[model samples]
Target: MRGLGDHLTIGERIAFYRKRRGYTQEVPAGLVGRSTDWLAKAESGRRRPPRVDMLAELARVLRVPLGDLLGQSVLLEDDNQLDDVPAVVMR
Candidate 1:
């Protein structure tokens, strides 16, 4: 199956995760200590966060790995758990 990280910009990925987590723009914006305008700008691709730590906080609030927010792959499946379904997400 395709992942959320595929064929998406970083801003698109953030909006996707934010919506999936049932967050209003204000929710994560507040949680990450930013204004709504900041998040809106980010989601709209009008701005990019200047710090990796800021990105990490957004990922935390949205319950996704930072790599996912960055539109990069995150492999969560364990090799020993071959019987379980894989939930790998990729850039």
Candidate 2:
């Protein structure tokens, strides 16, 4: 079985938490003073890593612990090595 911590790239993780908290891109974008398209780009991995402020706002909206967004978890049984990845981006 795939774990939630495994299958998620940074953008997908953001999108997952956003949806989980009932937030649409437009809504959080407005709250954070960003354009909806920019948020879309972030969520789709088309943009580079979001700025710190954006990440903070996203964390607030998603209600996730900040460490989760920062990818700080490491279960001994998990060998995925997903740690140290702050964000995912399309090149």
Candidate 3:
């Protein structure tokens, strides 16, 4: 499946990445220390997005950069390239 559009809400982004990575709700939910029902609600926009700390964990588990899930522009650089962009610290 295609990735989520730039205009999608956070909930949609989460669901999109989850599906793209071929993970069922139970898998990611458990990995992120959340219940499958909570994940379902979050994906459907029935619940608020995960907390910032949880967001990082989600990104790690989903194998996506945090910026992608957070709807921010991500800069990809090789090991030899130095990234000049300011880092966003999710607190």
Model 3 stretches astray by more than 4 angstroms: 1-4, 74-91
lDDT of 2 by residue, 1-91 (tens): 1256665556677787788778888887887788999889988978885765577677777776544665555233266433443443335
Best by TM-score: 3
- Residue pairs in candidate 3 whose N, alpha carbon or C atoms collide under 3 angstroms: none
Residue 11 miss distance in model 1 (angstroms): 0.9
How much does candidate 1 score in TM-score? Answer: 0.73
Off by over 4 Å in 1: 74-91
Summarize candidate 3's per-residue lDDT along 18-85 as a digit string, tens digits: 99889999999999889999999978978777776687788889987767777776565787342433
lDDT of each: 0.72, 0.67, 0.76
**Displacement of the residue 66 alpha carbon in candidate 1, Å:** 0.8
Pitting candidate 2 against candidate 3, the one with the higher lDDT is: 3
Measured with C-alpha atoms, the lDDT of residue 27 in candidate 3 is 97
Q: Candidate 1: deviation at residue 56, Å? A: 0.2
lDDT of 3: 0.76
Candidate 1 vs 3: which has more TM-score: 3
**Residue by residue across 1-91, what tens digits does model 1's lDDT show?**
1353267766788888899888899999999899999999988878764256687788889977766776554555566322322233332
